[model samples]
Target: MTRLIVAAGGGGDAVAAAMLHAALYGDDERAVILTYAWDRLLVDPLPGPRGPHDFTGLEPLTRSVLSVPPQARPIPPADSTLPRLAAELPHTLALLDPHHGAQGITRQLEELVDHLTPRSVDLLDVGGDILAGGDEPTLKSPLADALTLAACAQTNTPVRLLIAGPGLDGEIPPDDLRPLLGPHIHTFTTADTTSIAAVLDWHPSEATAMLTATARGIRGTCEVRDAGLPVSLTDEGPTVHEVDLDNALDRNTLARSVMTTTTLTEAEAYSREICGFSEIDYERDKAARLKQQPPAKPDLASVLFRLDEFQAEARARGVTHTTLRRLSEVLRLGGSRRDELRSLMVSARPEQYVAPLWRIA
Candidate 1:
């Protein structure tokens, strides 16, 4: 029996979905992943999610649904890692277009279900942010997840909500997520990460990287994102937990509010109304500011100095590790300089953990 997994919230969730598939099905040819083309500011500076129109060479699954093939590329000015993920991941990577909003997403899901006729439909969220109450002060992005939840709730298919690496997104704390989570389904092992190990080297997904790292038995406090949010990596970090679809919808006010949204604009508006802000607005402002600044140059001494200072401070707060993405932010590096920064840091400290993470203590 095949499973249709929805990579809720996109970005790292797609990677997590691949890992989950590996853990559950083990190289199953019948599995399919439906995900959004939304990416981080570092990957896609344009802000927000990219739709079918933003890419070339997408294979149409239905009239409204498109699958991202290995050769598909995001048009210039809009960037993505979906094509790369398609190339690396074993399952078919289908695109989830939110341009038409929740109702449209529901239609697309129904079409996929009818077309594939999977035995089970699963919505996979990398972090537990899909359970957000919309009032969490740390909630940075809720629209995409909310749209996915609302859409899945409307689908005729009985969708299972699987949350891996609870609180890893740094949006909602794990302590805050305990009451919402259901039974622990599975814990990913080192073997489950084999398919995604090389991809993590260049992927800008801090949460999924952390999840896989924890699965590999790396522990302690790890920092992530621009804010350098510290997430405690515990044995539970790699465990997948299931939550009932209806119960999840009941807890997420943003999801309920956007249930009938017909356009991305409408859904984003509800996100702001319910969550007090939309992540896209932050992305738009950041993109505008990025356009004004010149590219950053790699400075090894400055990076080391900043890393020393940050590590001293982070150690005081009990943080032992941090993501390369967070390190790039701390050093004010972006674009190609981020890559250069990683190379310089790795050269300087060969013992540091691989590409996505560095051991500070």
Candidate 2:
């Protein structure tokens, strides 16, 4: 399914991580729908742009490769406008403060919502209450984040507060954050200095994949662009499909395209080998990469599996794997069932295991 992952900050590495994971291992065909929420509020829509615009509705500064809207395209009734009241205190004060009330901006905002609703769009406040600055005047209404979550129950789409950046000290977590987040929030922090394993402990994925700096020596200060991951021989490395990022903003169009796209057949074998390696190397290397320390071995099992899967596919399509390690590797991996194949390769009692291909073929 075409999934929408909305992140709060424009420089959201967590969203990037999610996108990279989706690119590598998602089912059917997939694309990363990235929206920079903070940017949407501050920037004006560009002239024309296609693909997933950096901000929803706001096209690129230049003309787009495809047809799309200029303002943030409200998802009609489904769209929720997560106001930055917590984050934008000065702006909120100007709007709600008595002296500036003559501008009637609050009424204008209300009117805007009224106009958009007729178009089947909704504008909601989707964010944390901590940004509200805890000032009573600022919190004139229910926190936007809370309001947005409540609004989700009324709409067909799920809603979440997309927080960004490294500082997460006072953010008011959703009462139902876990339910609304549903494995979507990505955390980037400076306090995780103990090890890669410790930092990953906080992740829902349980360090199945480690996010490290490319330099391999910096502690607790990893750059998003330089982030590294040990190759687990899985498709969960990077995005395999070339998404324009602009076209994917529209939920309906992207959803339909993903339904018809073909998945890479080699994903099964790669996942199997990656799983086996993760278990075998868990004790030694998983913690090493966490602390900005180098491990004895560079785990490129993911890459290795991808290569082998490709070779095996070629062999099945009438190619050959007669070279040195090719034949034995194929023998070791009898079929394509990831979980069972991994068990067969790694289980203590190898004799008791049977390849699924033997039962079927």
Candidate 3:
């Protein structure tokens, strides 16, 4: 069967969807992976979801059957993490822009159907946050996943909404998801977790990394993307669920609100008013502040000091580790010399727990 999987939440969800495709479908040759450019503001500080400007080689695709031209720019290189990581990956990458919102996504799905003629489409979210009701206090970034879910629910093709790794994103508590997914949840095979673990080595994603770590029975304190919080993943193995897509829009509050939204602005506005948060505003403000400042020169002392601050607050709040690179950016420090600092610090403190950039230094 021809299969197309859209990384419903972007970031690690794209990779997670690819892994799911390989496991469920047996081979990825028949699969086409679609993902958006939005990443954690901590990792990519861009103001808005990048589109044609951020990608390259779409001019020609824009010409041919409008085969959903790549929205990745090759010159300055795309700041969004997934496209850069796509090179080392074996999946065919397609780009989606939230600027187009659900209407644009549905159109892209139709165009992709024209191009690939896929028999099945799975809109995948790695963590169970996609199952959130929007009023959950822990829901951090619900807008992206909600937009995808809302769009796919409207599409004509047979769409399957799959959520793997419950509570991995740390956005929705497992208790919140378990009841809704009780009958729908299924287990991942040993081979599946093994494949997931392999990808963690290639693509450093906080959400997926935590999922794999949990699948391996890793317990105790670990770092996360937020400096003030370190997340604790229990020994529960990851749960993969197949949600009935026909009622997806009516099932979730956020999806229902954005189901009719034609523009990113309207969808974003709804998220702010209905969900009580606006990730778009948060990203834009963060990027604007960074652009206003001259980058602080990278230094060991300042980096270490910031690390200390991150860990102290994180411990106090019972949160996980933050990304070091993002923490570097948070300090207004340049990234070119981050590796040099990492090497030096690795030897200096053997006891220091490091999780790529997602560690409590």
Q: Per-candidate TM vs. native? A: 0.96, 0.23, 0.81
Instruction: Summing lDDT over every window of 10 consecutive residues in candidate 3, give the lowest-scoring window.
Output: 60-69
Candidate 3 residue-wise lDDT, 282-359, digit = tens: 777766776787567656687677767756876676655444444555555644344554555565554553333344
Where model 3 places Cα greater than 4 Å from the true spot, the runs are 27-30, 59-78, 182-204, 292-298, 301-361
- Give per-residue lDDT, candidate 3, residue 219: 54
Rank order by TM-score, top first? 1, 3, 2
Highest TM-score scorer: 1
Candidate 1 structure, TM-score to reference: 0.96
Candidate 3 — number of clashing residue pairs? 15
What ranges in model 2 sit over 4 Å off? 8-28, 32-37, 40-148, 157-361
Q: Rank the candidates by lDDT, best first.
A: 1, 3, 2
| lDDT accuracy of residue 40 in candidate 3 | 55
Q: Please provide, for model 1 over 235-322, each residue's C-alpha lDDT reduced to its tens digit, 9 standing for 90 to 100.
A: 8898899999899999999999999999999999998898889899999998898888755677778778888898899889888899
What is the C-alpha local distance difference test score of each model? 0.87, 0.24, 0.65
**How many residue pairs clash per model?**
0, 23, 15
